[model samples]
Target: MTLTAIGLAIAATFAGWVASLGPLPIGEAREVSTTIVDRHGKLLRAYAMADGRWRLPVHAATEVDPTYLKLLFAYEDHRFRSHAGVDPLALGRAAVQLATRGHIVSGGSTITMQLARLMEPRRQRSIHAKLRQMVRAIEIEHDMTKDQILDLYLTLAPYGGNLEGIRAASIAYFGKEPKRLTLSEAALLVALPQSPENRRLDRYPNAARAARDRVLDRMVEDGVVSDADAAAAKAVSVPKLRKPMPILAPHSSDAAMSSVKNKPVVALTLDAPLQQSLETLAHDRAIALGPNISVAILAVDNASGEVLARVGSPDYFDDRRAGQVDMTRAVRSPGSTLKPFIYGMAFEDGFVHPESLIDDRPIRFGSYAPENFDMTFQGTVPVRKALQMSLNVPAVALLDRVGASRLSSRLKQAGADLVLPKDETPGLAMGLGGVGITLQDLVQLYSGLARLGNVRPLREIESRRGEEREPERLLDQVAAWQVGNVLLGTPPPENGVHNRIAFKTGTSYGYRDAWSIGFDGRMTIGVWVGRPDGAPVPGIAGRTAAAPILFDAFARTGKLPSTLPKPPRGTLIASNAKLPLPLRRYRPLGELVRTDGERAPHIQFPIDGSRIDASGGDGMSAAMPVKVAGGVLPITMLVNGVSVGELDNRRQRLVDSPGPGFARLTVIDAKGAADTVVIRIQ
Candidate 1:
């Protein structure tokens, strides 16, 4: 062989060796951008990858405007389709132009070659780098189709700091996507990547405008756009700074993204328009609420259990209110919010009918005495009237008979997490805001009532095909109907009620928390207003503070409030006279004669305000056995209205030590008759 032939054979062998090393380092070239979209595919939020670059997904010419694509081909590579990887005609013209002008003007790289350079970035400008790019460009042409190459170019081109691709640039600069870019906006995007840092519209508006006009002039010369169109495009103003991306449903987006990790596109169950409007309302209303107060709102589709909108706080960045904390998920006192469930359970158990005459007068269960919100009580009221008034005495009276632990168990079974004081069990006070719960759990409970006691797990993501689920039974259909009917008659807020919606309001002890939750046939909404730091805000009551917002939220949905369904079968809607004798009056054990003719069980020991010494043991509780003289077997002993334990037919029972303090002791028999005594434990 000749010497030149030998040299060509050696070079070919080395080229083959380099090809075996696999493709060039694309360096997150195909990194899918994480996006959170609403049910309608509207963007709610966008997060950059770990590398801090907004590399949004992009497609070929179709993903971009047709006019922009034509201008790109005319200016960047007129013969892009005909070229293998490099355009020889363009290269020859560039070489001639350089020679004639004694300086370089236009580049000879095709779109594919530009993509190759972008994939394997090199800082040094040299002939060797250019040759490497050319070889890689040819390799890419062999591996990918024409459309794929264009997609890479569209996605990998840099626009400014920490931003790449036409989609990112369009959203940041114009507050929109590239699919519907105007003539001037398209020209600006085309010119940006050429000199990203120098022509950044945020920092150098004049330079950006000049670069955009240059592209428009080229478009006119190339006959891609009319002269009049180019002139009009040149006159358009460029954005001075990057506008923020869509940030609706901030908390919901964060939560959904965290749950589904590393996903590029996360479709949530939120309604974009509804979420935006609620967020604005929350912000404006919170500002009016007072300093250091945050508000949270959650709206759910009752039938599907899908969360339509969740505003975690009025302002997520407000440090004063601890706004970063998602109040919907934070544990706080729910106050009278759970009263409806107690009544519903009572109705289900046949303990009381809606028209049953229950005494709302002053009542005491040990030292734990609960009063109405207004510090006064109605002498005697029907069950329906007491519930609508949110009378605390009646709720506690019913909860005592229902067993607080049973109430807690029912809630847990329905997918609610209650946070009680350390080492303290469920008690009568718990029925009156003594326990802790989150707004999310409270909403779930109310949603169950709206679904007629069927509790479906809350859904945050868009439902995928073939997903299976089951609804839990929280209460019987009849019980749920009674509760809904009673709550529907609750007095409306300042704005008169135009539609029927069953709702309940709650105010925690010392005004630390305020809550309002409501539900209709289709949707259920819950609102919370309080300081996230657990600081009390005087005069912040649920009926006045949170209920107003809840009512407005339903109104702002742009649809009239849905009316609840009629009472289901077996629901008793009759007056006291028409109801059965047992259902007409709720008489406790001591209040009525038992079948055996023995006086209903009563406490004969530890008289009211008696002091007893128990210093022989630890500081937690007194070391004395509580004494119960009369009544039925299986009695319950309570300290401060919280159940300590149960007692059998025996007269004396060992009781839990309730450390040194003034504590009230009470005994409840099987018939719900309760006798209380105040004593000092030491």
Candidate 2:
């Protein structure tokens, strides 16, 4: 110790001793709560006050783990129950050791003194230090309950590194809850009060491990844990070292820190594990896509519109290649991902429905006429099908039907960031996502669908220093589900899986940029892989490559509930967009013939000769029944080529069905022929 620092310590000690009878000082400094907690309130990170504040209820003393509390007592002050804040014996021993050996005073201060020091101002030690420490210690003993003091200590102690308190510190190191921690882990955390930075688990894993083990051994010797338990804990894998994205993990992010800095923290909807999972996935993707092109992966919890993880770049510290661009928050062109927002507005405007049809053939909007990726045409189709294939012409066509001016206004209303040239770029083609947007915006926009159309901005930081806002609805829940239907399904252009996912994909002009944005009930993820300079990265296409990543990232982020945040009023149909209730009636040709016997004679065969039936199991069809030979014999059929029918042993009656030759016909002849016979028996 320096002479001045030593002198200051001695003077402070005497001052503390003299001041013990009066008001003891309490450090009111707001130490960071470094507790790492899971969505379920389990601790994940172990250690510190730096960037810590997670949920710590005012009455959270009950949830405080006994083992962790005991550890604070054992390490900070072994005789906490009897001490009057300052442990004279330990202090005297510390004094001897320091004067002789030089270095840390070891475990001499009582928990009260440590708490006093924590809440007090930092200063070089002096003779007055002992008096100051003693006084503050007495004040703490007088003012707080053992549990309250314990809670205060746990909430204030500094674990090595930026971790300040137990809450933040818990997840910071061990990747589990403090209450759930093994004796060894709790002891390791206790050891951290001396120096978190000097004992970073990641930077100095060996030292941390040794210190951690020794703490465990101490606990075992003190009867805190059985030798067998200590041995078992040691045998367990060294719980994860550092938080997943410490550089950006909820533990390290400015946003996460600000959320809990001022008050008892609450559990945030953000998932560190999910975020870490996405970051790893994104880094690998950035590497695979090659150098010069950086990729950002963003995952949003659909139910709450909370963004779980955002991998800003390939590697945050890697300056040359993956500079600090948080693609999730940074504004960028979302390409087609922005299309759904327009759809949401249109849905609100009552211009379309899931089954509403539109023309996909190109039509000029001023100087710009949006072309399909293949430059092909699919004359006319429903809005639902257009969205299914992400057909450009149909989307622009629907936008025109909704009117661009209203569309723009609605986008602003829905919280889309509209930063574009006054008149350039988006002609009628803007609906096809010619308009630019960022991944964050896309996630938020999809959050409308994800959260039932209540599109709130994806906030990186919490609203209040200590409070959280109740989630608001942005889009109609029904419409959001409808939109969800559009984003996910069989990976299109043909068939993949009816694998239920709802998302939108976009490939920009010249194929330079490709984006896929959407969400299921559980998560919303947006992937943008392209050149930052506006030039194209070769071979990047939305469905072909980008969508897969979106798919992978979304699937990997964990499944969540599909509750839709309430949608803004009027955006959804109160009853599912007036969809047909699908009231289907089947006439055996016999029923129809019985009702309209006069017309029954117009049939090529008698209605009585045929047994009636219908297909399209969901009652999506009106019916048509046919009769062939006498005794309701077998019928020849060729439906699109494949034939199917029966009247032999399998069936013996004139078959009454919606179709005898439609390719999807349910039945044919004994040869299983798709009926070529297109006659109506009725």
Candidate 3:
């Protein structure tokens, strides 16, 4: 052999030795590539929070219609398969251009080489880097087969930081999964990896299209496609991208995966539009409440057990992991939120009915004597009246009969953490929402109860690749319906704005927490408004305050079920005039029972203090100031109806005695709905 031949043999041997380790980006590890879709499998958001995680959804290679995949292949890597790793032909041409014409004009690597470089780290690109990449490629070829390598390359290529693969890249660029990729969109994604930072496909479409056509022409010449097919692909129009994915609750829902902690991707049961709208409404409400008031909101899809949205605090992206001490995961006192569940369960278990008789009178639960909102109660009341007024004694009595342990078990089955004491956790107090649970847990549980006892797990995100996991049934379908009927705010005939909602409110022991959870045919929402320390926000009850938040949330979401659960066929109950009615002050709109319909109630009482105005008035704003302004002043300033600091009724502050509760204002609507809390003279 000639000396040059001997040298070539040695070089070849060295090259073969160096081709082992693949080149993946090393310094900054790529962020997880993730895509979030909605219940309908539409992309809602692509989480490419940092620069390292880009996803390219896997559009089935066969599904890549004529012009699409081929066009993309032509634009991205014409000599993709013809070369081993580097395209020697392209290299030779570039070399010729450089030697004869001067400056370096084109890249010398082939698509496979690019894939190898991406799969390994950027640092591995030296001659040794190339050689190692080749070795790994050869090994990969032997193990994975060509199709596997292509799939890996598609999923692992980085578009930028955080976007580690093509699936993510597809979502990031076009806001949809790859299988649904259109020709123009596929063309765009394929053209991105070359200069992911500069030759932006999303922004510079014309340039991307030009590059795509070139790829098609190359594919035609390489025999991967025919001239006519290439022409057809080239002629196909670009696909219009659906709306861009939202950048909502950015990494918050990512935590939903931590609970299971095993999968690469988690598909949450969430309604995208509902989630987005819920968050937006909560955010806007927060904005209206002033930047100082940090608010968190949670909602769910009524039919499907999907957690639509969870905004732990006002800011969606702030310290996603740290933002929540637990991020809507921790359970706290459910306050009145538990009422609806118990009521639903009660209605299901047949302990009470809308017309059942009960004493709303103050009753003692063991030694714990709970007080009604007014610390006074109507003597004998109907089941609905006891619930509406949130009368303590009656609720506890109901819990006593159901047995707290049974209710707790029911809660667990419904997906809330309600641990009962060996003595049954004193749920008479829990009937008032004494049991602690999370806002999400409350919503999820209540949604199930509202769903006629069917609890479907909710999530903050959607999955891109897997089959939609069917929900675990939580409640008896008939039982859930019964519960829903009792909680339904509106009856037939005259459904109000919040006509379809079925809700209940709760206040924890000693004003510690306030919660209102309820749902309708289409959606169920839960709201808890209070301090994190569990301090009582004086005078607030499930019906009065927390319930309003739920009402507001449902009204804002717009996509509620139009039809409601009808009473069982021929399931008629003759009305008894002796039965007492359930009435509360200023009940939130969503919780109002629409009794004006075909089989609706007659003489629907006005929410307490509902203006009997022969002369009409606007009644009162939910934010109207209710204060104690009598000769006897309160000892402190009332915040949300609670006396915090000494009352200051100007110099007119009358030296007062603490008689009964602090003097305060109460607001009730024209209907029987009402809301009242205690306040000091301030």
Candidate 4:
């Protein structure tokens, strides 16, 4: 046969043998550690691969430093961009050196070849392995772009032990990302991957430093770095100890991962800086508050309902504190934290006003008689004061009037999981501390108050978009405003600024749980401090324990407290005497019973001190409603002290709204009983 035909046959045989190796394992190369980041892409936490290796994903164009890439190419494969899997000149030089010295001097492998070796690791080096790597390198170069091949190398290259990739090494050694690296840091990372195990920074500092210096020397020789820069880089010492991977928001990270299984990156709605600060605050405060006590904090954006920071526990590894338990979701007695909702319900029902007088004396319902936290009660106080002080009897009385089941239902409508004791229907005692709730739910409810009655569900994962639902109502706009205004006046803890945040404090029975939930126009934060085992901590009241933390959390948000929403229309801004007769005092249905033959007449509608929409857009006065209760038949009505007309058989009348400005309303019955109210008609 001719020599040309023989050569063609040999080449055909070699191509067939190479094709028998099957497809490259690109799927295996794509596997990476799952990382959880904040909304801004800041790392919150990371989990190792199934094989217990820290191999974080990388993007060559954005994540890696340019200097490191330059140094790496100059030292590892100078002709990397120009070569097709291998350099013939470099291989020829290596062959010549090996023949003269009877030893292997260099591998002459390009970056693509190194990537092939990493993707398909061999237990022992041999001619067969080298041949396989060469074939795989050529296949990879044909299939991938230069940048993609660099990205794969960045992700899969080993540093030492279980840490793979430049990111893992940078975080483990320098506690930072690889976006910006010092000259020495870049050099150290470039060198470690060549002989990762023998030159581990933590295990063999001397070997690691020597390898790093050698890389720097090569950069100097190649004119990639000046001699002066190389000298400074070599002067710096290598890291001697590896840091534990970032575990900032462990509980939040775990939750994100579970929700997004198999995702390479899980992004959440958390703020990393705020989260770290709050975690530090919790940890330091927990230590100071005695042992076995853990603190949980949850902050949410009032407008979007996105969770800004969540410290599930003070320390996630503390066995005594049961820190692994996410206390933010743990159900515990809410104590007085539910008082604001009770007041909100009462306001919504129109039976009470903030200025209405309510008795705070000891009260009973069936077998339950609730008392104040201090066991003493003021005889009578304004409803506003009752809520601001978190008085027990007044709240329970209001709850009784508004039905416990309704309050629970309203809260559930707002997306709060209100857990009543087993088989015990929601009752009056729930107003104080009979029900269980979680810090996360509490924060969500307060966020509703900040949003003026409409609540958006709290969201943690950024990618998990919630389906649009009907707007959840915690209270009507006016009622929610009233509740928030009352809470805004709640006395601040010592050293705390007043009226900056609308907050309520609660201590469960026996001091088992201490909670403080607060909100402003922009955000809401809830704090829980207690034993994870539900064991009581004496003297651990909400005001002293959790309220301070809540205040500190707001301060750490790095912005001024946003003001609450403006009062909506129809809101009654009034004093006790100026309120409508029925609204002047809040009396439970039972206490409202009258034994006298007939009660005096009183105005029931057009709440006093309210702004009446008397505009009469059609150019005439709008008929103002005049409703009367407890009056004899055919009562007389007067507007601005001038007689308007007599009431109908229903004892109700419509009077022309005298004009704009203030007006006096009077109702007089046959028995000479009369009632008066002053209001602004506009």
Candidate 5:
């Protein structure tokens, strides 16, 4: 056969051998480490792969800094683009140098050849190994683009212990991504991969600097960088320690990863900068509040209900404060933070208008009594003023008329997880923090108010592909506007600079929890401060502890406090004189008089025939409390006609169950009007 025919036959045999190997394990070959990123693709946190290597995703020339790519090309392979994965001229030069110098000077392996070795990973150096690499490089070039070959090398290139890829090395050493590498940082990353173990900056700063300077000198010689740039880059100090991978929004990241496992990258709705800022704020505030006290802050986008920032605690590793617990999801007393919803219900019911008169004096509803946050009361204030001041009496009075069960049911319908005490029915105290709720729930509810009464569950992972949840109606548009208007006029932090964001502050009974929830047109934020152990932190009040933080958070976000939308059609924007009769003042509970000249007292608690579990489950016989509403003062109660008790304060009165059995509850007002019901005590 002729020489050309023999060459063709040889090529055909090599092609047959490569084809016999079957398809490449492209997916398994490029397994990258898991990463958690913010909405804008900025790294929030990263986890090592099963092999304990940081093999981060790399996309050839685009995913890396242009300067670093240029330097890498100018130094690693000058004729890389022209070569078909192998350069005969460069190999010949290496041969001559090795023969004359009695040593191997340069390997002459192009980027593709390096990628071939990385794919199979053989440490031995021999003629046989070199030949295998050459064949593999040619095969890789045939099957993949130049960029794909480079991507493989960048993904699998070792960068010291457990660190691989330009992105991983850049983030670990320089504390940044490779997308914006400086000259010095670029040089350091380029030089480390050659002899990663020996020249690790974090382990051997002097060796790493020497290697980096060599690369800088090569860049200057190759005309990739000016002499001045090289000299300046040489002057820059190499990083002596590897930075911990970013752990921003740890709680959110953990939650997301737990929900969706093994994802190469998980993008969340969290804004990285805002998340870090809120975390810092939480840390600083927690320190100021003393040991064991933690601060939880949550900010959400009103339009999408996406949680931009959720700082569960001041520090994730703080054992004393139980920082690992996500307080944003913890069920705790919401204090008067929920009063707006009560008044919101009243507004929706058309029982009171923002400008209408409402009494904030001490009030009672049968056996339940409600008191103002402050011991004093602001009797006969505008409905707006009553809500803005977070008066418990007025809120409970409204709750009495609206019915606690209705309010609770509405909240549940609006996507709030309200935890009531075991076996206790919804009571007037619920209007004053008698129920348990989470900061997240409060944020969602407040976000609804910001969205003009539409409520949706807050979303954490932006990439979640779940079916969209339709927004539920939490309050009528007009009522929502009235609530927002009232809260917008609330006193700002002591700085006296009002953000014009409607907000409310609440201090749980016994100072166990301090909460402040506020929202504007674009965003809503909720803040909570107290000991994580549920212990009372004396002197911790919402206005003093959380409201300032809430305001500061909004300020830090760099978003202006936008006003809510203009009132919808049904909204009344007129003075009390111009308002309709119902909008002029709160109607009395018994305004619809009965024919007997007496307003019958309604048993609010036990709900007529509702079962009451008299056992506390702690080996104690807890008495069942009976409550009444819409009754004249000095109401008398008869249990099985024995006259169990008589009390003036509408506070809950505990009555002995006489063991679990059916019992009769009767309430009579001084007017001789009576109401009766029977219930079973379990």
Candidate 6:
């Protein structure tokens, strides 16, 4: 009786020790690959885990093919669903085979046991490790469902070097997902995890084929597959090479990963097919452009402000061109890409009409002299013609009329990060690429024009919540419409259709950057082509280098160019003659001409360097007296470069004061001669 009591005590101790072993490490933290997918859930790019393994997240019940699963179950663990984890019949058969054959025929490790071994990897294979795996397997079965165990196995199973999951193996070997594997592919995948390194298809194709045939033979004997199917699958050739994983939009994927934290999957507002096409387009064009040249393209949906596709560089691996740099966000000279905004600002100021005649002659603002791109001038062209031709002098002149600071502020308000040189303010030179802007900001600004003046911030990540933001105004609706209409008439490149897309081109100083940005009714695309190192590519002009690619990218979007916004309310549709006399022609500020006994127009009151107390002491601005002695009568008065109105008779008038700080007051007469003075308003 004492011996029986001692045996019971030992049994109780053993049970207690087993219970103290605790739960298996099935729920322990394991690194998963960070994946960036497109809007349709297509893989764009994936990063390896911390240990340099490609363990992609898998949903075994849905993401994996059923044939592969059936083959796996048949080959690895037939009673996987029925057994608790350790299949007793299989283990007993393995023991009997070992005894009869005098050698181990099969260890009879179930899929759950394999998963447990993978979770707690051991270097030395021993009986102790096998016993631990069996215990863990039973514990895993108690903790997880069949599907969950299958998923963990699918995720952690090693298929080759640096590839730990079916998804990674499929992408590397077959260049596709494992959603619909062929018979041969399914068999090969089923046989890979047994001895992954030895059966690596890229290194040992013959061994891989032999192992795959074994799986096929077993499946046939088990009646899981027909004899004909097994023979056909075995006859198929094994891949001798491994394909690189998907790396589309590498820059965008990197950016998304940097911004999003702790997430295994990142969904972006990108369309995979479109992104792939544009990346190809960028690569082809960069190759054609010459050595050390790269291209960047960004496409945004006009209505939703979602970035549909973004190609940051021609080739992400090309080191000579600095191809990994995201040129879409690079701050470089914008050339005349900002001209449309200048024209839009002029239209909003009410002093200029599209049909108004303007001289594209040599113009000077202080020490700054602006000239046309061809080193020649077109005298007295209509405002529409001047902008469509992209005349540097005309744009600069209009920018002088529309205060440079105001233009910079307006663009900034609309969400463009304009970079100026150190200690330098916005000037007329900015109209001709003296300042810096990025392709993304440029495209965002153009989207405002397509949206009829409201700028929507571009969104890329799908999980980002929309913030409550005030309407971002790039221009009034009528002004935006006018700018779009003018750009719509800009001539297209050779073999390009006219009036379909409203695009503008710009070549920065010294040809360092070539830019072309365009918009249809639904989308806006911006392109930049140059050496990412900022080295000048001589003779590479925007119209020749960038415009063709722009057209081609729009074509490759697989849709025709949609129409631009229609004329909004209050848009002036009139001829040059029909316009008001004051709006009949544009007159530059400080036009200094003294001919035929007519002195140049000059500002007399509120003189330069003078201070005027125009704030009526109630925190409101009062009228300031303005007097001019000039070459001609009916002189136009302008405060801060925007037309207040034409000064009335007596060559003197009182004008409403502008806001505090320095204000530029100017007067232009009937003869176009003008004068300006800067006064501090208090």
Query: Which candidate gets the maximum TM-score versus the true structure?
Result: 4
Best model number under lDDT = 6
Worst 10 residues of 6 by lDDT: 22-31
TM-score of 4: 0.88
* Local accuracy by lDDT, each model: 0.84, 0.59, 0.54, 0.87, 0.84, 0.88
* Model 6: how far residue 476 lies from native, Å: 1.4
CA error at residue 245 for candidate 2, angstroms: 8.7
> Candidate 3 — number of clashing residue pairs?
93
Candidate 1 Cα misplacement greater than 4 A, ranges: 1-14, 17-21, 60-63, 79-84, 96-106, 462-469, 496-499, 589-682
Q: Candidate 1 on 30-50: residue-level lDDT in tens?
A: 776788989887789889888
Expressed as tens digits, the lDDT of each residue in 1-682 for candidate 6 is: 6999999999998678778777666545356899999999899999988778788888988788999999998888989999999998988989999999999766689999999999988988988788888988988898889988898899889998999889999999999999989999999999899999999987898999998998888888889999998888888898999999899989999999999999999999999999999999999999999999999999999998999999999999999989889999999999999999999988776667899898877766779888888999999999999988999888988898787998999999999999999999998899999999999999999999999999999999998847525559898888899999999999999857999999999999999999999999999999999998888999998899999999999999999999987787657799988875667888765546655878877778877889888877678878888888765777888775466778877788889877788777877677666676778887
Better model by TM-score: candidate 1 vs candidate 5: 5
Per-residue lDDT for 1-682 in model 4, tens only?
Answer: 9999999999998889898889999999989999999999998899999989999998978998999888888777888888888778777877898999999655577889999999999989887888888899999999999889999999999999999999999999999999999999999999899899999987899999998998888788778999999999889988899988999889999888777888999998999999999999999999999999999999999888889999999999999999889999999999999999889877776667899889988766888888889989899999999998889999999888767987898899899898887889988888888988899888888999999999889888988766546559788888889999999999999857999899999999999999999998899999999999999999999999999999999998999899999999878898887775657777665532246767667678878677888877778888888888886666777664345668898878888777897776766565445566668887
Extract clashing residue pairs from model 4. none
lDDT of 2 by residue, 65-183 (tens): 67777776776677878877778998887888888889764657788887787777467776566557677778778777776777777766766655556755675566544657666
Alpha-carbon error at 514 in model 6, in Å? 1.1
**TM-score to native of every candidate shown:** 0.83, 0.61, 0.60, 0.88, 0.84, 0.87
If both were scored by TM-score, which would come out higher, candidate 3 or candidate 4?
4
Model 3 scores a C-alpha lDDT of: 0.54
Report the lDDT tens digits of candidate 3 across residue range 215-310.
556566667667876677678654333234455554355564344343334465565676677676655654554333334577776676556766
**How well does candidate 5 score on lDDT at residue 35?**
86
TM-score of 6: 0.87
- The predictions' CA RMSDs to the true structure, in order, are 9.7, 15.7, 18.5, 7.1, 10.4, 4.3
Error of 2 at 333 (Å): 2.8
Which of 2 and 3 is ahead in lDDT?
A: 2
